[model samples]
Target: MAPPQASSIPGRLLKALQSINSSAPRLIASPTAVGSNANPGASRRASVAIIIRLRPEDSPPGGNAASPTSSAAASASTSPFAQALPLPGSPTVAAAAAATSEVSASDKAAYPPAQKDVKQQLERFFEQDWVKRPGTTAEILFIKRATRATDKWSGHVAYPGGRHEPDDEDSRYTAMRETWEEVGLDLAEDDYLSVGALDDREITTSLGKRLLMILSPHVFLYTSPETPVPELQESEVASAHWIPIDLLTAPAARYDSVSVDISTRLAPKNAFARAALKLLVGGMQFKCILLPNEPIATGALPSPQAVVPNAPLKLWGLTLGMTLDLLSSMSLPTDAAASKGSTKSGDLSTYPHAVAALPQDKGALFAPSMASIFPRFSYPDINALIWIFGFRYRRTLKQSPTDSARVNWAGMSIGSYYAAVRRALVVAVVLRALTALGGLGWLGWTLRKRLQSRRTARALAL
Candidate 1:
């Protein structure tokens, strides 16, 4: 199926933001919004900036390509993309007009229009000549953190953010400060407008029982597409990527699993331990999406554009949770239940097909990510056992979505309520350990039998 036109993105996005206030449960998460009570043992607050911009088709940052703000001369000239829009008499517009025309004037008068209810303006926005002028694609900024021994999220694909600092005035400032320090974007400047904040999130250790920090994701839009290229800070950031929205929504771009090394967290100090653990565990599976690394230049950091491997980057863990919320807002109205159950908030009615295009899990309960869930082993039996254990836990969360659980993504809760998910991992590890010991015992028995036979042969010969 054809992807949704990038032309319609701005309207849909605006519509989604407009509905945040009316949501039944009030999932308005602002970066500056006062921090709510912390979860037990979770005192830290962190914020990330989700910076979005429109990448005009085939136009460079400073390219002379025509823009929405360009002279009237450009709009007067015909553009190729304009032809595909629903023209006045076309069936789509006609159907829409027919639908709205049927709405009685009395009914229209009784209920004032909201951004969500103004389907006609949204339609008109799409119909504008400039919108269809082979215009821009929406893209969000992401950064690959430099490998740091101290950072647990080192080398992970993430939005720009850091833990709230004492000098910072609020969580929003933490995001703004870290963004300028890590990437070169000055979000506080006039070039960007703060759209709104996503619902707050919880950072937790694996098993989802422990709380680390509360995460607030703030959204910002570029006032102009000609915003300057990002300058990477070498000490914290390696490269910056502007990921296209189309890729994020594509069902094909979603992967069922990613391979994570088991030794990174468990056996960092001893090579022998690492090798033994890896030999047994190999690589475990987690939910992930494929992302290409297109790194931009960095003047702030000397030769700071770190060389990325040819492999596509994986988007999982807490970052994935934030992304899922962004994707859900695309279909927020269709599911008011989301507003009530979700801690988050999207306007995807402009493109119905992409709404709820939530990435699905194949075998594991990869409901976005809370903390890094322990991965399932390569052994199918072990994985099946793990899933079976999590079955009740997953079912409970599914039923009680509005239970104030701190972890949710794509309309699903993950951590804090995933004790069973963690317990399953512990069970799998114990089983693997027993199986390894059983195999060693059989090998030892076989060798002892062979040695006895060899001695018998020598004695017979004597």
Candidate 2:
């Protein structure tokens, strides 16, 4: 028989494939996919919205919790972590007194005795560990995460929030639910007034890849005169504190030269290898703020060594950015110029002078408006190549000559050298073309002159 027609074979194969496909199970979409289809905006919803309450002028300062006669004393005495000390004559008290005496002597030697004012401040911090009500400023709430070896954010300072759950009506509800779950501060809409929301910022990996989570910070003011203390939810939150907004605005709050490790691989033990690795994967530097300290639970151990003590609660990264946004919304200066002359060494005494001396020329300090916190650049995609090449050239020129690895041709950096060589080649090409054109013009002139002379000679001969 003749070979089976290819068309007939394809039809048979197609029929068999169709039958198999019809029997196959249909793929189901995930909950997230379904949710996105139902509400497209849910994908852009913020994972967290931290509340910022404006503290009243009469509110107690941070250390007011430590004073027995202070308004915070009532709350402090009722805290679950608070306990009565042993009687003075008891064996427990005597032994503890002796141990304290020994430690005090050693501490005095290691650290000079604080000045009278400083000593008073330290005493206040010990007495009142929580933010007290009736204050002249605003207080920003922060949460210390529960320690877990497996979690990347374990034991880190963060605002109370979590990923959006299906049960939540929206992101705001998600924030409220998480806050209540994490800190047991039942924040109902009637309990607090909504101040506003900050811009949404994307969460990213160490290498800057976008994650599914986004942060939307929502500010709120407690309606009641007194600031309520938060009950800790030990599973997710170790402690929560309300930090005074004034302290945050103070110049002493800012700390520079804070180094952050961003290496993806384990740091090399060898010195040379470590240096090479550092060059390959550089660390990020940030301006961090020291947040007010929270009262440590009785018998609780100190925080992890990685936790920087620049502030009682260190605020950095996205939290700091959001804090700045909050400040800007209040018409307060968010730029470093506001903190001018307010060096890390400056104390609270300098606040009045610094505030009074704020630079008259606000334009010199930062962008004229809060909306311009970060400058925006608009350019067409068609010019992207040119812009990128120009940027590379400028960056190369700014690099140190000692960084030989960055240097390409001779002493010039790669980009600059490449651009220079390209320019030279272009110039040479243009010169060559001009010279050829000049030669042709000269030849044409000579030929015309010779022909004229020949014509004249021929005419004379005739």
Candidate 3:
């Protein structure tokens, strides 16, 4: 009789599934032969443990949220006790937790209440700066860690800004609203030179709170040439300070090596050190080492290779990453300009004696460089190169698709490597099964034991 036909949908499905399963590596043994392995009991136990770990624990009998674990585990999960717990996707949290569980274990310890009050207090403080002059420096308030509310990210410093309120008509309105709410500054449009929308980022507060702060930092220029007074807002903004541009530009003002050095002559050494240290630390630390002052003319702003206005200052974590991204962006050409110029090199080997046969000034063949495009651009090529090296590197400089073909080849290689590894694993399992079934070692051991006993008996008889 002919084999049964798989005409029905179920039968067809079964056949298809069998074919697919045959080609795939086996993950489970058939139930009928499950116990027919060298270590069936051990394997079964491992499988059961894996399944249990994957299942969500049943809720507690009470009205309260279901408890994942009971007894000591519940108490140990408290913020203070849980500080050392690993947070998902956190590179530092794991190492930090292991190094010092005491500081990170509990929710309260990891993010205390003090951190919460600072954001609220600082927000209120910046609201009072609205009527103030432009061109003056301002310190954006940040939350401290010890008094933070949640474990998500506690005790981190950040700008005081929130979602647009009903009264805010536009981004400018929202900026002012946040400024009023967070810091006591009441800023006006004229006070702000430019308002730019930066890349949106999600941030977690120290109190375990998550928020999407669309950073639209208003470049407020002090209109008042006179000394400006900062009004501190309650709960939101705790305090404010006027930071000088020179302080940021000076080599003596950074925790790391400065890009440029300021001319210091005829300044008092002790006074210069104190000022420089203050500029470097800026509430980051209690004290820092700094260079001594030469004179009033000695401490000048060091001219950097490139200086972009409103360049982001990276502090920590996501904020730091975002800040770096912004700084990097200052160097990248827009999509339009990136498309300019031919990437091809002319055949120079045919005319080795002629310099003209070499790769033409391809830059001129398309659009001029950003520096030449904007003659007013003050930065030199060296400074621009340093500032935007990352952007330049990331750029797809090739005009033709063939330049990126190597990436495709690399991807194929990776896939081949993965397939090879899978096949090797399957072969290893099959070899192990064959070795176990043959029992060659066990048979050899029995024969050797019998021979040794017989030899001992013969020796005694002799």
Location of the lowest summed lDDT over 10 successive residues in candidate 3:
46-55
- Residue-wise lDDT of candidate 1 within 268-360, one digit each (tens)? 799998887676556666666677765553322323455445657778777876776675555433244443453332212111112233433
Q: Write the per-residue lDDT of candidate 3 for residues 1-462, one digit (tens) a residue.
A: 222234321222223223221221111111121344433212111100000000011311111321121222113232121222221110111221232232213211211112323233223323333312232232222322212233233323334444443323333344444544333344432332221222223222211122222232222223322332323233332222232222321121332211211112112366765555333222111111121221111011223533334333323433333322222222223322433453533221111111232233433112111111001012232223322432321232222212322332212322332233234333544555577667878898989999999999999999
- Scanning candidate 1 in windows of ten residues, the lowest lDDT window is 87-96
| Candidate 1: stretches off by over 4 Å | 1-8, 21-43, 61-134, 206-209, 251-257, 270-276, 299-311, 332-376, 396-412, 416-418, 436-462
Off by over 4 Å in 2: 1-46, 54-59, 62-135, 250-252, 265-276, 296-311, 332-462
Ranking by TM-score: 1, 2, 3
lDDT of each: 0.53, 0.42, 0.27
TM-score of each: 0.63, 0.47, 0.28
Q: Quick one: ranking by lDDT, best first?
A: 1, 2, 3
What would you estimate as the lDDT of candidate 3? Answer: 0.27
Distance from true location, Cα of 274 in model 3, Å: 43
lDDT of 1: 0.53
